[model samples]
Structure formats: structure tokens, C-alpha cells
Target: MTAPIALHGSNISYFTGKLENYFRVKGLDYTLHAMKFPGDGKRIERELGVYQMPVLQLADGRWMTDSTKIIQWFETEQPTPALIPANPAVAFICYLLEDYADEWLWRPAMHYRWYYDEGAHFAGRHLADEHLGSLPVPGALKRAFMRHRQRSGYTRGDGITADAVAGVEAIFLRLLEQLETIFRSRPFLLGERPTLADIGFSGPFFRHFALDPVPLEVIRQRAPAVLEWVARLWNTRASDCTGSEPDSVPTDLGPLLEAIGNEYLPYLNANVAAVAAGKKRFDADIGGVGYRGARYSRYRVWCLAELRRQFEVLPEAARADVQALLQQHGCWEPLWQEKLLPLLPGQDEGLPFRASTKMVGANETV
Candidate 1:
């Protein structure tokens, strides 16, 4: 008998949307358990050793965290209808692009949802109040819940300001322009078929840009073709494509990863920093990478180190290709290295990539 696949997530979550798209694209059999804000869902997630949702509770009882990890797992467990391309170079590029969409694109998406949209702003607060009502707390609990939500970096409710909203809008428009250039010639980001890049990007494009009324209007007005592509990707069913999986790095794939690490990754990081720091406004030009106006504390260092480690593990030839790509993309210089500090010892070293081997006797509380 097959093990059960359960997903714990909320509908309002972009990450959850990404996971759901993976399930649909992979034709995986699963159940989605909707969770209320500030609920026991996080406690269940902690017990299972997963940090965040859309967690995949595997049949053997092991849990998987992060949408990217879960999608990779699906590629291994069900090889048909491959989300990744057969060519290593193309596949690596697709993965890197997907990472950009998932990580950097999030800043603008969050800013819009929590800060710009009045309906979402109040609704989120109300949702928090309802979730906290389940507890036996006394007076001023609602205010406390609001404060807690503000502090939790995961919440989309607190990181809003007029400047932030403008930044998000700028990022969105820039991404659309880049995507239009990429997709105008090809149906997918790669060439012919939908790759992991398409699936990965579909989540944000669907939820924040395509669905959100304000951003959607902006996308429609500025880049209708990009919006069209978003629709095309979402409407696709897994059964429509010829399925095949790329499990190992192909020799030719080195250049792609190298390009991503050297050029795209650095660009992305810098762009994010600009937004967080308010050094640069979030516009089409600023959409490359880096969180502006945001601090590069422990969490930022940990994430960057993990990414570097993943890049380091690539074949030496692949590393060279990445270096070359970075140079080509004009990303050879280190711009934000001064602001970044090293992570504390014993911090969580969670890379976005993982192997498919299933461990027996893993916990599954959530």
C-alpha cells in the first residue's frame, strides 16, 4: 500500500500555492489540510522537524519542508511528466531561475498583499484574531496577536509601507519585462515544454501577480503577454506532456549553474538588499536580485551560505561555467559583501536542494 501524502497550508500563502502547483504538475495523490493563523499547525510542523509549510507528509511518515525540496522529491518519486529538462545545462538554468522567482519575487508579493491591499490588510488581522480566539487568553489578546504577527518574518501583514509598496510594484513590472523578452520567443522559459522553472514561477505569478487585483491590473496594463503566459502555464495539466526526469547533473549543464551563481544570484541578492535598505526603488531595473532595506543578519547569512555550499558541490567544470556566466552577466564584483555578517555557530543549515532517499522511522506529527 502507498503511504499517505498530506499537505498543511493556508490558502492565502504563496508558498502553499507553489506546493499545490507541484502536486498538480506531478500528478501526485495528496490531501491539503487547511490551517488557521497562529494555530497548532506550526507546533505540528515543529514536531515533524519541518520549519515551514507547505510541508509534505510522506507515506512512510517522514515530512518534507520547503516547496523547492518537495518538488525535487516529487521528481524522484514520480519520474513521469518531468518538470526538469533532459539537458543538464537547461535544467540547471531552469532551477536557478525558479529559485529567483521563489525568493526574490516574494518581497514585492508580500509588500503588495500586506501593505498595499486594504482588504488583505484588514482580513489578515481579522484572521489572526480568530485564530488566537481558540486559546484561553485574557484581555488585549487581539493586540498581542497583531504584535506577534508583525514580528514573525513569515507574516505578510507587517512589512508594508508606501515605499515598500512602490518597491514591490517596481519589482513586478521589471520581472514582467524580463519574462516577456524570454517567453516572447519560446512557449516556456526554456524552449518547448514546461520545465521546473515554469512550475516554480507559476505559484507567485498565479497568486500575487495574476490573481491579486491591484498587481494583476498593473501586469495587464504593462505586460499582457506575461500575464498570458501565466495563464497558459496554470491551465496546463500534467497528463498533457511527455514525462521524463533528469536525476543527475549532465556534463553540459555546468555552464548554466555557473551563469546562475556568478551573474543571476549576485544580481538577485543585490536587488533584494536595495529594496530592504531603501537605497534603490523597486522598479524594472531593480528586479535583478537582493533585498533592499532589509538587514543581512543571521538568517540572511545562513541562506546565502547554504546556497554557496550547493554551488560548491557542483562538478568543477560546472563551477567554471558558472564563473564565466557571472562574468558575462557583469556580476564579478562583490557589492553587498560588507553588509553581510557570518551566521552564528550551530544555525540551521537548510539548503534548498536534497536527495530523494527516504528514511524509515522519521517523525510525522503534523
Candidate 2:
């Protein structure tokens, strides 16, 4: 018998919650280990060359990093109870949503945690203690520093400032409303079964919305449907397991799709252009608010390239469907552009094109 896959991460981590939830839903043979920061530093750094969590150790002993890359491996290897949509256009939409949720929502997610004092104190202290409770430093100091780091990173690096806060809050409010409305109709984001899109959302939804104190209060009060959906995903069994209908998108999910087109895609397009222009700093007009000073992210830049590549490879009918869906929701242009977005080929070793199959030649099981 093969060994169980080893997942190293913490519940406090957003991406970690995502991978953990997915594993439970699939009943995959895996064991979870808390990522020890100070104690396990050497091994963690050696495997990833950076302190990244939710590392997956394949049964054969090969290791992998990056949540999306790991999910892509599962999509290719374990076809049963598929998280990815088989329809090319639907699959493309899933990938796009995954990318946006993974890369774009980092700012809002970080902001919500740090903006309100209640959440700020809870998450800040909780995370620092969970990861570094064993460290010699006082817990209060670590919390204070982490709180500052989380807040400033968004304020300084992701361009979240006084001017942009309103727009970001607008996104949060609209998202809560839209998701609540969808949940009123269906259990999962797409339909019955949880798709990669649902998992994408779970990164923020589970960690921030469901867990954080302030947002949790907001979710419980303002969006009970949202809370209900969260509870559903947490359970091993859910009421809506009918799965998505073939070649279809859920009508209830239109608002989210629209938001993606209107808000997130604009920033992505601007970032894509910025990366191509070889600029050190990038600027964007998000929701009519001007945001500047965030440096280009090689990982996000690669996300755009990866998405366009997926779109480019779709079949004619599938391409037509994707175009129509995106166009209807005001998201066609950025992705529909003729020129491929630039990718960081040499500079980026963070996320690979795919998992390594060379070492396990003639066999692909994880």
C-alpha cells in the first residue's frame, strides 16, 4: 500500500484552510501536520527555498509547493469527484475565478482582517501564537508586529490606502450580498458539488469570513446564507451534491461573475500592462479610485499568462461559449486581447507550469 500524503500547514493560514477543506471533502488519504515555524525552519526552507505553508509531500517522496499547482496535479491525477469542470469554457471560467481569488483577493482579505480592531487583535494574536508560540519573544510583541506587517503590506505594497479603502469595502459588501443571494438558491458556488471555484473562494471565505471575529459577526448578522454555505462546505456531507450540469453556469452566480469582470479584471489588465512595460511600480484605477505604488508581482503576472494560455487552447465551440459568458458579464477585453500577456520565465521559479512527472516515469499517482 502507498503511504499517505503529508500536508504541512496551519488552520490559521488562508491557503491552508482551502487545502484542508478540499482534502476532507474528497476523503483523500492525507495526514495534516502543523507547520512549526522556528523549529521546522530548516526543513521548510530547504524544501520550498522559502517559508511557504501547505506543502504537499507526494506518496513517492517528491515535494511540491503552491496551492494552485498542487490542485492542478490533483485535477490531472484523481479524476473521480472532479473539482474541475470538464467543459472547456466552464473550466476556463473556473481557472479564471481561481486565479482571481488566489491572487487578487489577498488585498481585501488582508484588509478586512487588519482594518477592524476586533479582527485585527484576534487574528493577529491568534496567528502569531499558533505559529510562533514556542519562540522566546513575548506573544504580544509578535502579535503587534504581525498586525502591523499585515496591515502595512496591504496599505503600502498592495496600494490599499485611504482613497482605495472605500472601493475595497464596496467590493467586500457587494461580495457578501452576492454570495448570500447565491447561497439562498444553491449550496455550492457553481451548483451542487464544490468545484475549484468554491475552493478558490474558501481561501478567503473560510479563513476570513467564517473565522475572523469581526467578519464572522458581519457574516452571521448580515449574510446568514453565507454562513450556511460555509457550514455546508465544512461538513463531510452536504445537501446539494447534485453536481453542476454539463456545459452550464449557475444563474445565481451571475453577480459574482459580473463583479469579477468589472472589478478584478481591470486591476489584472493594468498589472499585465505594467509588467510588460517593465515598470518597477504599477498603478490602477480600481472602481474610479486611483491606486499606485504596488510593485509588480511575478507570480500574479504568471497567473495572467497561464489564464490566457488556457483560453487560447479551448476548442472553437468552447471558445465561443467563454467569449459569450465573459462578454455578457463585461469581462471580455482583458482576456480577449490578441497578444499573450508577458510571463516571468527565468525570474519565477515559484510556481511551475506543472508538477514533475519525470521522477515517476510511466506512473502518475499521488
Indicate the residue-level lDDT of 347 in model 2: 41
Best by lDDT, which number? Answer: 2
For candidate 2, the TM-score is 0.88
lDDT value, candidate 2, whole model? 0.72
* Per-model TM values vs. the true structure: 0.70, 0.88
Tens digits of per-residue lDDT for model 1, 1-366? 245578776555677777777676666667877655455565644554434556666777766676766677678767777786655545655666677667656666655555444525553555455455565666366644554444344222223334445555655665677777666766666655677888878777776667666777777787777888877776666578653344433333334334444544564465445434544233222333333334223333344554555556667777676556545554434323435534444445342322111210011111
Query: For this target, which candidate reaches the highest TM-score against the unseen true structure?
Result: 2
RMSD of 2: 5.4
Work out candidate 1's RMSD over C-alphas. Answer: 7.6
The 0-to-1 C-alpha lDDT of every candidate, in the order given, reads: 0.56, 0.72
Off by over 4 Å in 2: 237-246, 337-340, 346-366
Worst lDDT run of 10 residues, candidate 1, spans 357-366
Residue 151 lDDT in candidate 2: 69
Backbone clash count, each prediction separately = 30, 0
